[model samples]
Target: MTRRTVRIAMNGVTGRMGYRQHLVRSLLAIREEGGLELEDGTILWPEPVLVGRRAPALRAIAERHGLEHWTTDLDAALADPSVEIYFDAQVTAARAAALRRAVAAGKHLYCEKPTAASLQAALEIARLAQDAGVRTGVVQDKIFLPGLRKLKRLVDGGFFGRILSVRGEFGYWVFEGDWQSAQRPSWNYRAEDGGGITMDMFPHWEYVLHELFGRITTVQALTATHLPQRWDEYGKPYAATADDAVYGVFQLDGGVVAQINSSWAVRVHRDELVEFQVDGEHGSAVAGLRDCRVQHRATTPKPVWNPDLPSTEPFRQQWQEVPGNGEFDNAFKAQWELFLRHVVLDEPWRWDLLAGARGVQLAELGLRSSAEGRRLDVPELTL
Candidate 1:
């Protein structure tokens, strides 16, 4: 049987996340890894047309993937009847416009997180897609992490009975682009470009928090721009308008409190760059990207503190390392596979634009809370 190809028009294909995460990974998965399979003994291979501003970059990407199609024309790509899906990895500010165009073209939509710069815009995009009856999905990749998956299992299995609270530490010092090149784009340091710790990471925490504990009801946040100026790749200084760090406390439904520390200025001294410590009545679990450790009531230590004594063991060593179960794909790649399956096999994909809206809503609330020096209530979406 012949395979059904899902011809994809990829916008922002030459951008950082676009080139490294989406385009390259999707091409390899569909063409090499047998990632997408259809029901009728057919495979769902992606026929991707690279789209971007720079012709040279697009051509280079196309050549790297052995793809023949490359274009700088958005309207031309959208006009092509062969394209069934429109994928956007553009900046947060550009996603809504790109998606609006894609929906008008009658194509299924898939894209990165914080689908739009504002909550209203994100909601509008979702409503428009729903009205048009086109399938839409947003990247909620962190939920696919093996560590987070294991944490979810523990929650589901009632290991963390009567869940109490969650603490998340996520950050790594992003180079200022002086000594070493900036790991992230310069737009990430500008507010007008929809760059900030809250906008970038709150959505990730939203899904993880909702999935692991419960929905976030309220937020009290304090945001900071620790470094007001940063140097670019060439040691050219640029003013930083976005907050580099954010300290937020979320009030989840059912009295579950979650504190999240998100930053671009912190050094990674732990097992993994990101870590979540969940405490409950029955047990406590500390999960990192590489490992997850739990201490139940039965195995937890009972000790009293002494002022004049030095300990031989580090507190971190008290918990044992959890073994890796098997091979795990990159978080973004895993979600790409799931999204492709949804498009091809009619599988249920939960990470839609509505979910994306929730993320934007939280970021807005965090900013508001920080600005006003007060707690803000997060309203539920009508959609």
Candidate 2:
């Protein structure tokens, strides 16, 4: 097997998603597993340099993992000729500028989304990356999820003949941190810090719908700040000006209607933290993070409505669970491996900043739709 190494400048990786998901679960996991083997028997060992604002934390992470590289100086990391790819997982406000800087430095660019606060800035980053002739990618991790993968497989297999509608339920109660501490970081509730349900989740829904069903044509949304005040980590209450919940409906290119409800205020009743149900002419399926249950049209049960009497049939039991068809990797890790391949082997990578900009556009238009109380058409994004 031909083996080589790619030096990656990993920035803003100290935060929760950055540290836990990207660094530990994905990058480090690959390293621990002896690197990734590509189709042509080429082994790509990804050597990541942890870059963040805190020097002590970077030192700790490197020492803990037996990694030799760690640095707080982003400028120095960018200046290094050995750093071939730049990855960012910073807060929403810091992502765009860092990505632009990376592109200007002539490095292959990768980052977490929204990519930018506005569509204009996101588009600019995409253009910059293209002009610089660097490979580019953005996180679209959910599409690789096992449950979603199964759904895609079933759809591709023609199990879902003539798709109709998709309903996505995503959210959980993030405590207000009165007596118990809040689960998410405090900045997630502040608009000025770039936090909101619409901004945080619509990107996921946009890509999911676009990749699975079709491109979203129009969007209508309603957003809310259910809890106006929330306690921070320091046990201090702060005004939560950003939206904590959103109910949105999207019209896809086909007649498929997708409605996704995202909230930090709701309680979970589904199989997972996030669940999506798709209804089609031939069958119906409900897919969670890792499991999917399906019911063919012929197997669907007829329920008689009688308020006074208990239902005879077990409603939930009517559907059968789809078996896990194959072994699955961590969804984030799966995407990371693909991005690495794209960077090293010149693989086709479509999830770039332009796609990320579309995500921002959806979030922006969702806010506009909520304010104007009308459905807004999603303009086609040109690369």
Candidate 3:
């Protein structure tokens, strides 16, 4: 079999999500597996060109991974004729401009979501990619999660007969950095840095809801900065200008109402860091990060509400665990392989720049709805 190398210029590998998920767990793992084999007896090998701001950090990462190419200059990386793709995992404020540059360089695009800080910018990026005729995609990792994949399976199999509603609970307390080091970057709480739970999570919710149930038709959101003041990475005090929590109610197509609460201030009380419970006329399912449980109409428990008396029924035990019929790889790696196939073999991929723009649009509308204290109709976005 012929083996070919596809050079990818990856930006922002120094960041948390960039370093851990995209670089180490995904790309490195792919390399360790001896590359992806295409249907035509050709192996598509990935050659990562790490790009970032810091020279020392980039050098360290390159040396640690035994990678050959590392650069601090994006223009130089983009100018390389051998590079076929440009991937961004940069901060929100820096993503749009970097993506624009990549598009201008005629490289295929793939990046983490909330394509831009605003809907307009995201649409503009999408338009540029369309006009450039380059293959493009945005990361929709949550949809690739094992639990969500099983949930999608159930939805496709009509297990949720006439799906009624979806309830999602996500997030856990991120420590204020004064005494305890914050789990997330300080930029995540700074509005000037394009940070906020709404901008960060609404995009995810948009794609997840749209892919699993239907497109969101309307949204009503209530957002808050529960922790007004927090310390930064350096232990310096800073005002938390971004919303730490968001309570959103979205009306989806096909008459499904989804209520999701995203918060960094709330302590975990559930089985996983994130969970989605979908209730239907015939059955109901609760899906966490890696596990899914379902309750059919026949097996669902019926317990009359008795506030005064102690409840006897074990409600949580009523649901049956969904079995994993197949081995699942890392979600990010799975999508990377798909995107690579799309770039090389012209394979069909639905999560394009347009899908990314839709996610940004949802975030913008959600923030607006929260500010206005009223439900807002979601308009269709176009490039």
Candidate 2, residues 83-123: lDDT per residue as tens digits?
A: 99999999999988888888889999888989999999999
Give a tens-digit lDDT track for model 1, residues 48-103: 88888899989887787789898999889999999988999888888899899999
User: Best candidate, TM-score-wise?
Assistant: 3
What overall lDDT goes with each candidate model? 0.87, 0.92, 0.95
Clashes of each: 0, 0, 0
- Please tell me which predicted candidate would have the highest lDDT against the true structure: 3
lDDT of 3: 0.95
> Which runs in model 1 stand beyond 4 Å of their true positions?
none
lDDT of 3 by residue, 230-285 (tens): 99989999999999999999999989999999999999999999999999999999
Q: How accurate is candidate 1 locally (lDDT)?
A: 0.87
